[model samples]
Target: MKMKPLGRTGVMVSDLCLGTMTFGTQTSETGGHRQMDMALAAGINFVDAAEMYPVNPISKETVGRTEEILGNWNASNAARRGDYVLATKHSGAGFSHARDGAPISGQTIPQAIEGSLRRLQTDYIDLYQFHWPNRGSYMFRQNWDYDPSGGDRDEVVANMQECLEALQAQVEKGNIRAFGLSNESAWGTAQWVRLADETGAPRVASVQNEYSMLCRHFDTDMAELSAHEDVGLLAFSPLAAGFLTGKYQGGSVPEGSRMSLVPEMGGRKSDRVFDAVAAYLEIADKHGLDPVHMALSWCRSRPFMTSAIFGATDEAQLQRILDGKDLELSQDVLKEINLAHRAHPMPY
Candidate 1:
């Protein structure tokens, strides 16, 4: 439960952030509220949600339900609203349920913030993030053949400037305290930082991207950017979509598991994925560690990691993660993990 600075914003956040993607879907409102209580008790002061959530099967019907559940908790705990840091995202283009798939622009920033504020029952968001680049992103396993050749450079910069101007207005109006990016690249983040600095808009405080033992995309360029630029990574999917938990090993898709609900595991399933999972599982076994703890601890060990965002479908699962909240990997375990990474990189 160590606290880390949310970039240079001077806001301290827990090393682990409570993720509420499954709220209002896999979890009941009572369960979601209980998990928040448990997280607060565990010293997790940061909670992350998106306007488009409850996404086992993201749809128009369930859009914004997760935020509504969080709002309910906020209403019930009005006195403790300041007890935690609240962060949420604006869904990018192609998210059909929000604004008919409109790309993020100056006009959309205030509208999105207003919706999130109303749904969250909060005056200001601690960290407001763009769910993804409107131009497109390589996150969610889209990096394999990602091409940036089609993008218009001038148009992209212009849009970023416009968005920054709008974000600056929101900051003055007390709509959001800080701004962030998600599923963004090193170059994209660099532009945001540059623009924010030049315009005095809220400097990009953090970048939320998927990072785990099985996924090492952030280990290179983005790692360098985060380290040098102070844009700490709020890593999502640190468990590799539960693959690192070893529940999907030997083709065993347990009932109610993510794999069972979404067979492809968001395109993370592959022959090499299982092989890579086995390797990490062996490392955990050899060290007498719970694989879930190992995966989460590994994420916490990274220099660029600000927080590892984790979600649980129920209180029992959330308790298991909280029980291992303070497990730190020894040098020997870390050395072995490095070796495993070299042996099997990018399994998906």
Candidate 2:
């Protein structure tokens, strides 16, 4: 459980961040609390949530339930409220369940922070992130046919300036300690960094994006941006939505698995995906490593990784992931992994 600096904020967070997307839905409150205890015992000091969470199948009825569960934990452990770093997101436009699908703007920053603070039962959020760009994003498998030609340049920059000004106000108000982004592009992040430099707002500390053995979109341009800008990546879906666990191989969809609940696996399922999985699974088998551990270890080895975010539907699964928390890949294993990547690139 090595600690790393979260960009330029001077805040040290665990290399592994506990993800709570399934809280209040697949996992009971007791289970979520127990998982937190387990994570803390294992030295994980970072946890992440979103306002539109519990999202295997997001619904209007369950909006904000995850934050409420976390709030309960905070109340029960009031003495240890300062023990961990908390991160949450503001849902972007087209999320119908929140704010009637409104886009993020200067006016919405304080309102969203107030709601998160009340629900989290905390004085200030360690990291407050925008769930996605209001103009739109290429994340969540949307990059295949993405087009950037429709955006108005002047309007985008103006909105960013306004939002940065509002975020600066929130910093003064002690509502949030740091700011971040998710599902954003290299160009978008560059603009935010430039604006924050000029406006004296909270500099972007991190960006949460999907990175795994099967998904390596962050390895190129985004990786370069992180190297120079100091914006570390909080990697989500490091297991490729559980595909790297080999539970979905041979066309087998286990009962109550993510595939069973959402058949498309968030646009990750395809004929090439299984073959790619098989290749990596073989590499793990050859080295006598658990595929889950291999995938997670590989993510942590990246130069731009701040933390690898992982979630479990049950305590047993959580414990299984924690078992390999100390495993480090050898240079030989890493070499084979690079070869594997060349053989099968972009399976999703």
Candidate 3:
């Protein structure tokens, strides 16, 4: 696997990042350990987790289980933890499970980091991210009626300055190496950058957002920010939560699948979703490609993409997705994908 620079953080991460949200939920500790070994063996040096994980049924009970699983692996294989770039997030807004839906503040930063460190059984996190902006975000299918009228700009910036200073203190304390943002907008990311730059704190290293063939919202403004500012994209749901994987192609949800657990696939199961999936699947077939491979490779092929965060419930699924790491898309296939995007834009 190839490595990419994580912004200006001086940390090189594998292009393919193993996402651990499924751990301790549909996947057990033993299963998660096996997946970790497989991912490491496959040269995936980056692992992504969150404080509120095991998210198929994200509950207070199973909240930090994913990080605990990674911590256990790190504890046992103490020597190998240093080889992987581990990234996790602080849940913000609407997640009553994490700090009772607390907006991320300077006060919450240390508490959240300490909780994550204990759960992961590690002293330092490679990349720590704000799961979403405290004010709010339009990433999760909220772009249709998205508005940023919640908080005053000065108040938001002051809050961010405080948070960034706290993060910088954590960096100085060697608790977290770098910082990132997720489910954030271009303007939101710019504010983070501006605050970090002005305050002499750590700049945002990456932004983990929903980016795939179906979701191209980041292609315009955020893409420009990423390219110029060196803030890479850690794209989550590059497969659109398996909608692009072609498993739910004909509206038949497979047993023991994520969709079976969360029937709506987190608001992705709309009437137009299958049409969009079919379009991509057809492009894959026309190009003599597996849809899953095509989907992952497409995400990896994007210029702004540093790592594609993917999760698997089983080793077989992990292997299938990993097989596409080296598969580069041809121009004709990309053209067809673009044409399909024009035909069925925003399927979900």
The lDDT values for all models are: 0.93, 0.93, 0.91
Error of 3 at 173 (Å): 0.8
Q: TM-scores, in order shown? A: 0.99, 0.99, 0.98
How big is the positional error of residue 8 in model 3, measured in Å on the Cα after superposition? 0.6
RMSD of 2: 0.8
Better candidate by lDDT, 1 or 3: 1
User: Considering lDDT, which of the candidate structures 2 and 3 is the better prediction for this target?
Assistant: 2
Tell me which residue pairs clash in candidate 1.
none
Q: Cα lDDT of model 1 overall?
A: 0.93
Candidate 3: which pairs clash? none
lDDT of 3 by residue, 54-128 (tens): 888888899999999999999999988798999999988788997888899999999999999999999899999
Off by over 4 Å in 2: none
C-alpha lDDT of residue 281 in model 2: 96
